[model samples]
Target: MVEKNTTKTYIKEWQKAIQKEISFLKKFGGTRYIVYNGRFISRDEMFTYYFDTSSSLPIPIGSKIRLEWGGLKTNGRVLSSEGKGMIVALEKSIGELISEATLLHDPWELLENLIERLDEIKKSKQKRARLKRLMDPTMEPKHPTTRIKSNVHELTLRSKYNPVTFVWGPPGTGKTYTLARVAANKYLQEKRILVLAHSNQAVDVLLAEISLFLKRKDKFCVGDVLRYGTNSGQSLANHTEITSEQLIESSNPKLSKERTALLVERRTIKQDLTRSFSKRDSDELLEIETKLARLLDKFRQKELELLKKAAIIGTTLAKAASDSAIYEKEFDLIIVDEASMAYVPQAAFAATLGKRVIICGDFKQLPPIAASRDLLVTEWLKEDIFHKTNVADSVNQQKLHPHMLLLKEQRRMHPDISAFTNQYIYKSLVADHEAVYTNRNKIVLQTPFSGHASILLDTSYTGHHSLSEKSSNSRYNLWQLLLSFQLIYESVLGGAKSIGYVTPYRIQSNLMNLLIEELLENENKNADIIAATVHRFQGSERDVMIFDTVDAEPQSRPGMLLVGKDSERLINVAITRTRGKFIHVSNTSFIKKNIFRGKTLRQLVDHQMQHNQQVTTQKIGYWIKNQHSKLAWSHARKQSKVFQDLQSAKNSIVIAIPEGKTLATEWERMLAKRHPKVSFTLVSKQPMQHLQPNQWMDENIAFPFILIDEEILWLGQPLEAVVDVDPPFVAARLHSRKVSEFFIGQLLKE
Candidate 1:
């Protein structure tokens, strides 16, 4: 095939030519001299030692000169017009220029290689037809796995193919765990894999997960795994098997030898330059310049060698793109974790380095952040391989190209906690058996008021807003800050293993950090805790979480930056981050009035109320007396429902109403002779004793309305004793057939 001489064909060549210019000028122009007399001179030195009175110079005196020595660049003016040579001033000396020039070799050679590969693919008809075949629906095959979860099995089989495969991972659906296992399985087959992500933290997370899986279950020694990236900090530093950049730099024999020799040479040059200045010898300067050039070339060669030997490499896209050492390298497969959070161009660039690609991420959690609003609307910029390929209603329903597997089983969140996201985002998501039963014991440990698993604190007050003119961080609300501290203290007292404070805005995060620091400084609790902005805590989770909804007022809006885009993603992330408990702090009235009609927090609160286990007890008084809603039991619809529950009782029922409570008088006046077969006992208060086996209640029970019988336990606060005002809070209809038998059994024993 003939190559066209367009920008696409010669872009890399242009880049190389520019880099060569920077290199040649740095070596040729980077020179410093010491005057015979005692004078310190640096930067843009004259071409001649003295001006020639006979020959006129081509350029005028006092002209501005810009000089770049390797990486060291600066501009200055000619200082003086001497007889044959003019003195020029500079900011940096020869030592600094030499140090910077040594690093002038372009590090973006890998990116250039990827661009060239893309150009080749675009220009070649055979490669394009092969890619088209890989994406063809007729060519796609159905392969099964021995693993029980169909999603993991499908992903493993698809990893062998040459086309791009997407694993649509909604929140809590074990994306990292699934991909790590697949990569490990491939490694056992001796296929080289490259794991990538947008951030170092994400890459480290995948590395940690991979190490844990290999050590804990597979029992496979992970000696071949290598982490190659700019980020030196690895969370799994103790696991010596996982090699990091720091380890390679410090331990590689060739790199160590050359770097050590270079350092020694640099020190000797500094000493020689000082001696020459005293002896009035200018020839040492040339010797130092020649030595610097040789040492730099040797250092770069060693760096290239270390990268070529790495079999299975893990790195962020930015590091992989810039590292020149890995330019010519290719992998059998590249697994991109958190692919949805990366810009399309970045993920595409990483894809060019490998033959087969596997992208695992949830577009429902968060999309790539675009700086300009216009870019968000641009069709091509918004596309991620994972999301773009997933066009079918469900993974199983697909009949055509772009193979995908949807991971529907969530194992991270409690059933009660996962219901929100399951409803709003992942309609097909179901909780695994372990996830459903894991939090059962944890629920009993929490006090009733602390929100057994989830709670929503809805306030009507306009929270404090202090906007800084210089930043985009949302202002902190004083009320929300106090509530976060209160919950943190409560969680600590409740024996929470760890706590995390999630705020949508930076200002709230900053304020919450102060409160957490105060708690630590006072030595109040030794609980493990951390507070961070929501964007920073994407790949993390904790035992219990407190999300501070910073936008409290109706007019201020919920999140400043999350207005038009689907804020449901932000909510899903916050809700699914906790395995034990989640508390949402926001203004209820504002959310109801101005937001998505209270669909976010209100839905969670309603879910919690629906899942709360009902405690059966005959005594009730405290709620009627303490709660002051005059029309509490006045809702006609609520009253009708309560009577319907009472009428359904097969045997005797107990009704406890505090004195002067209007609902009790109304019940007495209304239902004295309605049902003769069912016995009715009305009492002002019930004694503090075991009313049934494992059932007890104090005389001042706070619930305004209560009806406990052989079969049902109904407790609620009426809106107006009429039509439903707040359907979720108005009444709770709970009934278990065993409750009636258990009540009779207890009575017979008594």
Candidate 2:
């Protein structure tokens, strides 16, 4: 007898229904799907039911499930008969299971029963819909599985619109671990599931998940399969790193890039409805795209001259395949993680390879390409020409199919910090679970805090001869400032704090070498100093954050950081890196040296200058954390100290420093010595003139070319601090880097 419950489906039309006679695999290959109310799954409900290594039954797809504390497993449809067939097929024989089986009243039996009932209903509907929509465009997916929530009476509010779902679980939210069963259900049912991640470490974690899931499938471990986008993604491989240029290119060549392009085209058109791409300079880019589209038509028709003439547009979508006729490789699903910092074009370029996609991200963290003055914008042509004039239609943009949804609940930072972030960050979110205010589910990343943080404008120097001189000459006087802060914090703490050094480019990596060598590598000083790209820290757990905006371009604020757009799923990954304590160090001391030339950063710097002019010192307060960076922002401004989050931030702090003189000095020295033999020639072909600060170049400055071994070096003073333009042959123009003694000879004032 079916237990009568109030649970029912809300959006009558189920985009994906469970398949008949097939065991649910991963998101890609589940035999079928079941539709039910999803709104019932609260932010806290998805994890109420827990399946461990010991649970004889793996979490099935489209199953009515729930998890509760204590060993009392309360479930509805315990999957007694159909599950038997799946287990017999994937793991063991039906004979062995029946012979040894003694069905007990396991509390989870209820959940299994409920799932069967739901599956049975789905099966009946499938039988009808399959025949009704034989060639129907609306019923296109062969077998799409609706997301299942383990809490509440139903799992309704699932996302299937773009066929790509994104869940940004911060720190200990089990981001990687939770996908195990979800992935397995899709695979068992039969689907090609691709895991797209930015780093090898993340892929490794997912590999561990696959192993654990298979180990429990006593019967079906044979057909269980998994694959990564890279060699380092293999759980057992020990391969070396591939060059960044090579790694990003030809990655699954036709497959991945095609999928990304499709996603890019769709998302751009969708967003264009609300925001004007022209206002963002993306509209003018269309003029270039139209010319290329016509050229492409000529090229596709075997016109060689068109190819030579279309270099400009091809630069935007290098091999971007917009036509569906060329891209037909269909997949069950594509899962993308860490997407925020991803440039929009790169993400869209990779989506054409997948049939289905899921995206996840947190926008409030750090955005893509470091917060600079203004932002970069790019959009592709909409196959449909009718919507060109009135592209800002909100209805079309909001028409995210039932499955294409956003997740709002944030399980990463502490409530103390999340409040400050959400309040300051996502004023408007796209999903229900995108932001939650509680500490019940997050990891315990609590660090002690007492108001001791303060920014010290240090004035010292410690580096090699050339680097040391540059450090001394820097506008910020960073080395001397760093030493001063180190001395003060060392005296009180007696050891180094958990400090991190972040630079926008590899050139910045040189500066951290000395500090890291003296402490971490040498192990001479008792402290912790980590050097990493800001990209790697996304979705990580950290106590203190110190931003080195010293030479960084200025900016206003960021809305999101898209690192990758898997398939059609927009998974923003970078901006959600820090748990507490954010510090920014920019070369604001001399506004002219600021690398970024945009509206956002100018506003920030100008506002701060205005702020300092109004606020007096005696009323000011301060806080401290690591030995590097300035006095925490909480103490520098009275208005900021009122936040309750700051009350718990004694141990966590934000250090802000506008650029100064000394920091640049040491960096220049380091740059000159790194290429002691490098030489540069004037791009204008003019005789050497006075090398003054403002008159170093004429119009469209260019320089000589040389290599610093295999390492690619980006020069400063004009192209950086928020403006990202790194083309190998072109960078030499304004930002030159050559391995020759000629240029260094002239640059060396000594």
> In model 2, what lDDT does residue 89 have?
12
lDDT of each: 0.54, 0.31
Question: Lowest lDDT 10-mer window, candidate 2?
Answer: 380-389
Q: For candidate 1, write residues 1-750 as lDDT tens digits.
A: 646333333334333433443344444432233222222343234331211122222323344444444465555444433233233444444342131211111223333444555555566554444334322324444454455455556787887753567677776678887888888777767888888998787887777777777677655554467666444465757654565534455656676676567546545544544444322323343343355557556655654554566556788876666565543467888888888787554565566566777877777776765332242223323445444434333433523234666777877766656767776556545445474556545742564234456666543432222232134434556435554666676667667767788877776676667656544444345677878877766777777888877665323555544344556667777777787677777655555555563455555544544665211111112112222111122223457767665656555665544333435444554455345666664433544232221222333222233445554544342222211123233333434334334323422341
Mind sharing the TM-score for model 2?
Answer: 0.38
Measure candidate 1: CA RMSD: 21.7
Error of 1 at 682 (Å): 57
Off by over 4 Å in 1: 1-139, 142-151, 212-223, 231-234, 244-306, 376-378, 381-383, 390-402, 443-451, 461-473, 522-525, 554-563, 598-602, 605-750
Q: How many collisions between residues are there in candidate 2?
A: 154
Model 1, TM vs. native: 0.59
Residues 451-472 of candidate 2: C-alpha lDDT, one tens digit per residue? 2121212111111111212322
